[model samples]
Target: MAILEVGGLTKHFDIRPGLLGRLLSGKRRQTIKAVDGVSFTLEEGTILGLAGESGCGKSTTCMMIAKLHEPTAGTIRFKGRDIAGLDRAGLRDYRLAVQLIFQDPYESLNPRFTVFDLVAEGPRALGIWSREETARRVLEALSLVGLKPEEYKDRFPHQMSGGERQRVGIACALILEPELVIADEPLSMLDVSIRAGILDLLRDLSARLNFSCIYVSHDLSILSNISERLLVMYLGMAMEIGPTDRVVRNPQHPYARALVEAVPVPDPRYKRPIPAIRGEIARPIDPPPGCRFAARCPQAMDACRRDPAPAMREVGPGHFAACHLLDMDAPDSGTAARAL
Candidate 1:
């Protein structure tokens, strides 16, 4: 059974103008569709990668899943229970079961608190453990993240290196032994040299601890290596989703293809032409009808502009894409699919 399931998850932010502007505009409000109808299922002990460019709603989606942001519509089910409808006690339990790992460790960690206090905050807040028990748990968590509690527990965030601070952030999340972890660009702010170590630690810990994870980032190469499955999102909607290797090698959506092509090759001599995606990303506030990506899609046709947004279609085993070009009934559909 899937450990987490999100269906038609949507979050819209109301752009309320200032008093003067509102008076001039007669109270007209604009809505920014930060996350629109994103749906997916994550199996137990598996990692699902969410990849997209900046302002594409990756962080917003993660925040919604973490219950940091309330959704405008849709359902989030954890182990078959709707999170949105949970009562106070249930919500408290949910908070302990799910945790978020922020992008910037320095910013996320409380400088006022020592490493031991940071890791012990959750359990202490819930009043789930005795004073001595909290200390024991904090030490165990510090050890799990490769930090010796006796040596490092008394130190503040400023005392640690970037890599060590990130490990400390990870330990904070794991101290509660969360069942689901939503990691939002946890490696983006860290040094490149230490990224591999963090990734390895995450992989090892997830395997050993048996917790499901949602890893969000704009780094395609890293996601390809770390995630079991990949979901390519654009303008708050999923463009493609499939096995990591398959989607990285052969993306079905035009947006997904452009993202894959944009990855720089390590060899200086190898010069494959990068497929450039034309046009600026459309504004999310009151976006136009039909396919959101049609304005910039290289393969978009008149039908794409006139028709409603396309639904996800299975193009291969366990691979799905939301593109009008994948209309299987069309005569040229086979040709288009083959081109991908």
Candidate 2:
């Protein structure tokens, strides 16, 4: 069953000019489309990897679901209820049921708080359990993350290594027994050697604990290792989404194909092809009506530049992509490879 569902999830940030600039030029406020019309579902006990470039709004989409940002428009449904309409008590419950693991472990934790305090803070703040119970649960959470609670629970964030600190951050979310965990680039700052360990830990814990996960990363290689499904985004819009193997092995969108091809292979003997992307990333502010990726898409045509951005079309079983090349009726559809 799907534990979380999002539909037309859009977030727009408006930039208002300073009083002096407003007086000097009389310029209108501009809007930045951080996340535009994104939709996906997270099944119970499954991991969905959200992949995109840095400015493509993967983190922003997760933040909106975590309630850090009120979406400009869209519906976020968790467990079949609309979160936007939740009451204070309902929202509090939702918060507990959904926890977030931030990208930078060093910045996400409190320097002053020890491992025990950090992990127990959630339940303590909500008064979900007694002090004794919270401590017990904290130790359990630490152990679950592969940290020895007896020796490491008293250590400060500054005292721990990057990988250890990240484990603590995971423990912080796990302690809440949340049904959904949003890990936003959790391994981006860690040493390369330690990334696999953390990835394995998360995959193991998800199975043992039966929790759903939304793992955000710019790297499709990492996502292929841990995620059951993949959602590829570009310029704040979803380009393609499908099963992990399908998306990684047979990406159906030009942007998604570029992203997959960009992943470096380990073998030294293998020759990599030239990337298919070109031109600079289009500005999100006052974006044009056509496809956001048309500027860089190698398969872009006049229709892609002139018509409205294409809606996602099913190109295979459970696989969908938004690209004019997939439109069987378009004049130039046969000119480009239909695979994309």
Candidate 3:
């Protein structure tokens, strides 16, 4: 069953240049296309890994899904209703169903409150249960993340290790029994030795708890291990999306190929392909017409400069890529399975 669906979702931010910079700059106001026309779906009891560079709109997409940021265009339908249309009261109900596990553990947790108070905050804010109920639920949530309620409940954020702090963050999200979790780099800040354990904990929690997940990470290695599917984002657009094995093994888009090639391999014998990307991303403030990846894509044809949408070619069983190269109709009819 589909738990979350987002279509044509876009977010643009108004950027103002610095005082001295504006004097030298051509435009006073600029638009940052943080997320532009992204679409994807997540089925229940599965994980969708969203991977891209720092400014490629990965975090922006996560925020839109979590309802923390309102989209500039398009619809985000959860369960069935358009959550973007919800009012304050309806949004409260929406928050309980969909939760966000922020990236920074220290910034997300409350230093003033003990673990018990921090974890219980969500249930308490929603007024979902009585004080007794809050305590009971908080205890259960703490245990779910591997912390003993009695041992860790009274400790402050500063007292525990990095992994423990993150567990507290997870406990907070799980307290609401949310159906979906948008974990934005849940382990990005953890110590290297403990990162794998944290990933295992997330996989363990998702299985036993039976909730859908949007696991956002820049690291393809982690996504390959934890996600059921992967979506590659570039300049706020989805370059490719498919089953994890398919996307990682035979990436269709040039941008996706570069990312895969960049992944470090332990074996010296496995020859890595030459990376195909060049130059930094151009400003999204009125970006050039044509494929977002055109400037960076090595296989750029004259038509790519015209800006084409992903034509949905079946690269694998359900794998798809959005590139003009895959979409050109052959002279003879009927090899349609490979249409972009």
lDDT of 1: 0.89
Tens digits of per-residue lDDT, candidate 2, 150-211, equal 99998999999999999999999999999999999999999999999999999999999999
TM per candidate: 0.93, 0.94, 0.93
**Per-residue lDDT for 1-340 in model 1, tens only?**
8999999999999998778857875767978898899999998899999998888899999999899999999999999999989999999999999999999999999999999999999899999999999999999999999998899999999999999999999999999999999999999999999999999999899999999999998989989978999999999899999889989988988999999998888998999786768977765877777777888888888777775788887777678888887784544553334333
RMSD of each: 2.8, 3.0, 2.2
Instruction: Rank candidates, TM-score, best first.
Output: 2, 3, 1
Model 3, span 185-211: residue lDDT tens: 999898889999989999999998998
Where is model 1 more than 4 Å wrong at Cα? Answer: 17-27, 328-340
Off by over 4 Å in 3: 19-25, 87-89, 268-271, 329-336
Q: What is the Cα-based TM-score of model 1?
A: 0.93
| CA lDDT of each prediction against the hidden true structure | 0.89, 0.90, 0.87
Clashes of each: 0, 0, 3
Residue 279 displacement in candidate 1 (angstroms): 3.4
N/CA/C clash count, model 2: 0
TM-score for model 3?
Answer: 0.93
